[model samples]
Target: MKTDELDYTLPDELIAQEPTPKRSESRLLVLDRDAGTLTEDVFSGVGKYFESGDCLALNDTRVIRARLKAEKLTGGKLEIFLLRELGLGEWEALVRPSSRTKPGSKVVIGESVNATILEPTQAGRRRVVFEDGDVLSILQSNGEIPLPPYIQRKAKESIDTGRYQTVYARAYGAVAAPTAGLHFTKGLLAELKEKGLSTTTLTLHVGYGTFKPIQVDKIDAHVVDPEDFVFTKESASALNEVRKNGNRVISVGTTSTRVLETQYIDGEYRTGAGLTQCYIYPPYSFHGVDTLITNFHLPKSSLLALVYAFGGTELVREAYAYAVENKFRFYSYGDAMLIL
Candidate 1:
């Protein structure tokens, strides 16, 4: 498929700048693939579409305060966005003003953390080594939440610290949130459980690559960056049991879906932990997920391609067009879609 096939025109105003007042209050667009229909409802009422014994698989990866402000020795201000930890005090980071911060450059982060730029890496990133202290602790005091570039705000408000993350986020490693899970609240999860739905969590540390655009004209030429994921024995057993009983496995987001699909082998879920670059696009056969609950994704993105693969090309195209015409919000802090 051509990457241009996924393109859609979205008004700038419809890109969500802020979250809903309440998490569960966001609108839900239900796409019933079998029926070839689309319906709109409140996210809190999403449980009504599920049958008893259905499994809800969610990503529990927590977003880290990866965006840090720093100043070079020459007094040039720069932003260092932490991508992944390379261990031994070194990290792979995207340093803004990369032209200014060369391999030997030194920058000060707050009062306590000083870092030396080590080397340049692919895609305009830098290798940074921090001077003697816990980097995570330093981030807690001086770092800011790495909001997506589409959210044009001069400064992050207090609400962003909490609202940008899911209620169930636990394992802390992700630079970005598994956004599809953001609409869920504790009350909604409990309500689903009371309806005889079982929920399990796997961790996929969402990387900045999730927002990477498909630069290639042909979709098959695009490659996804590897992201680490953890699917435990307990979670595997729980989801496998759901399939054994003939229940649906509803993936909460693309991140969780990737982990499940990566670990599924020989017609069953397997327990494991590793990095996965499992890119999903149109014409791909899904082996793990029966239903998908996801947020509206950017046009010409790999994320949108995955949704097209799951929901069928023409149906998703119509659904996106309907969403735009109805003035539904878009992107991370936006409304959701349940593809059944």
Candidate 2:
């Protein structure tokens, strides 16, 4: 299918610059896949759709302060966005001015931290290793919460540093938050627990690839970069048990759904750690996920296409149109939708 088929025009004002004062206060657009209908509702009404004994899975990967600003010894400023850690403190990252600095170039941030470029990734990304020390601490002090380029906000104010993360975030590794999960609050989680809803975690350190726009005219021609994911034995065991008992597997975000679906096939669970480049489009058969809780996605995006695949294509299109007309927030740090 033509990538242009996925395009939709969004007004500039509709994009949320900041989060609502309360996480659960955001709007919820419930899309009933079975009924092929959409309804506007409050986010707190999320639990109304589910009864007791259902499993809701969340992506627990935490977002790091991954955007770093550094300069070459020649004092030229450069921006580095951490993508994926290769191992031994080496990471694949997006580099500005990558054209100027080739292999063996040195970069220093502020006065204390620095790194060396080992090489470049296939997509012109850099393979960089920080000067020996704790990379996380260095970023914590120097970097800011890396918002997507489309977001108009410039400075990472003290407020965003906290709001960008979900209350359930743990296992720190992500460059971006599992945005759909962002709408969930600690109070809401406690309520779900009390209501007899169980939750499992599958970590996918959300890399830039998940958000990078698909450029191919034919969606099938596009290639999605592999992102790291870990599904532990405990989580997998619990998920299989849920399926066996005919319970719902409610995926909290596209990240969890993509990785979980890849590992779950033929009614059996494969507990493992690996990278997945699974791209879901129309006609894709979902094996594990029963319901998906996700945020409104951007047009011409693979994420949106995946949703159309899960809930029929026409159903997603109508849901998105309804969301736009009803003033529901959009994108990362935006409102959410529960598809059942």
Candidate 3:
């Protein structure tokens, strides 16, 4: 498919800059694929559409404080965005104003935290080695929340530290949040459980590549960066049981959907952990996900392509038009869509 097929017009104001006051208060857009209908509701009432025996698979990857301020030895300021850990003190990172930050360049982060740039990696990323203390501990004390570029803020606010993350985020490695899971509150999840809906979790550390644009004209030419994921035996057993009992396996986000589809083989869920480069797009058949709950994605993005693949192309186009007409928020901190 041409990349243009996924393009849509969205007003600049509709891009959500901040999260809703309450997590469950965000608007929900329900797309009944079978009925070809679009219905709106509050996210807290999402359980009304689910059957008692249905399974909800959630991504439990936690967003880290990856954005850090650094000062070059020449007194130049730079932003080092940590992507992933490579070794005990080494990491894969993106350094802004990299034009002059060649190999062997050194920068100081905090009073005691310093780093040396090693070499350039794929897609202009750098290999950085820290010199002072534990990398994770240094990030905890000095790094800032890595908000998407669309969210404009003069300074980092305290609210973002919590609101940018999901209520159930546990494993810590992701640079970005599995946004669909952000709408769920602990109270709302408990309510769903009481209603007989079973929930399970897997970890897929959302990568910066999630925001990578589709530069190719043809959608098939584009490649997604591999992200680390883990599907444990317990989660696989629960989902398989749901399928055995003829219950729906509803994926909470595109991240979880990728892991489920990747681990699904021979008509059964398998336990595994590794980097997944699953690039789901239109004209593809789904083997694991019966339903998908996701947030509004950016125009001409791989994420939008996956959504279009799950929901029919024309149906998703109409739904997006409706969302724009009704002024539904867009992007990571935006409202949600449940496609069934």
Candidate 4:
């Protein structure tokens, strides 16, 4: 199908610029897959859907401070946004001052660190190879938090660095937060456990792929950038137990869903840790992830396409229509939808 066909209009005012004071206080729009119905509630009410014995899968990929500012020897300023780690001192990145940075130009980030712009990579991204003895050390000492462009605030603010992350972030690799996980709170998890709802965690280092625009006319031509992910045998075993018990295996975000599905090889789930470039769109079958909890996504993006796949295309279209008309929030810090 044409990518444009999936696009919809979202008012600029509806994009949430800052996170709410309390993560669990955001609005929740409940959408039933079977009945094709919509309901409104608070995010804290989400725990009510899963009774005792149900399992919720969460992504624990920690967001790294990936934004960096460097100066060229020519006295030109360059903004470097690290997209993902490609190993061997190489990284996929988006370079500002692209015009000034030629293939051979060296951008010095600090006294002991620099980057050389290599050949251009796919999707207008550049291959920037780092020249640091310790890449992670250099980034930790100089890099800034990589906030999404939609938020019209300074990423240097204390709240930006703190509030942009989830309480459960553990594996430090993601450039962006799996925002759907942002709505969860420590108290909520404690309550879920106290009520006997099982929980499991995996890691999917979110890359720019989650936000990459649909450039192709036909959605079929679009591909994704590989992101680092990990699914251990313990989590897989817990999920299999849930499946055997006939309880719901609810995914908290697309990151968790992708990792779970990536670990699914034949007809069963396995344990593995590596990179996955799984591109999910509508009219596709989902082997894992029975239900989903996600935030409102941008029009025509692959994320929205996944939502369309889980909740039928017509259901997603109708729900998005209602959300727009009803002035619901959209994007990173926006409202959420629970598909059951």
TM-score (C-alpha, index-matched) for candidate 2: 0.97
Q: Which lDDT tens digits does candidate 4 get at residues 10-59?
A: 88999998888899999998899888899999999898888788898999
Q: For residues 72-176, could you state the per-residue lDDT of candidate 1 as single tens digits? A: 887899999999888878889999889877788989999858999878988888998999648888888998998998999843657998998999999988998
Output the TM-score of candidate 1: 0.98
Candidate 2 local lDDT, 20-111, one digit each (tens): 89989999888897787888888887988886779888999998888998888766878888888888678888889889887877899767
Model 3 residue 97 CA deviation in Å: 1.6
User: Which is the winner by TM-score between candidate 2 and candidate 3?
Assistant: 3
By TM-score, the better pick of 2 and 4 is 2
Task: Please give, for residues 220-302, the per-residue lDDT of candidate 3 as tens digits.
Answer: 99999999999999999999999999999999999999999999999999999989999999988999999999999999999
lDDT for model 4: 0.86
From the highest lDDT down, the ranking of the candidates is: 3, 1, 4, 2
- Tell me the spans in candidate 1 whose CA falls farther than 4 Å from its real position: 155-157
Instruction: Name the candidate, 1 or 2, with the larger lDDT value.
Output: 1
TM-score of each: 0.98, 0.97, 0.98, 0.94
What is candidate 3's local distance difference test score?
Answer: 0.93
lDDT of 4 at 67: 86
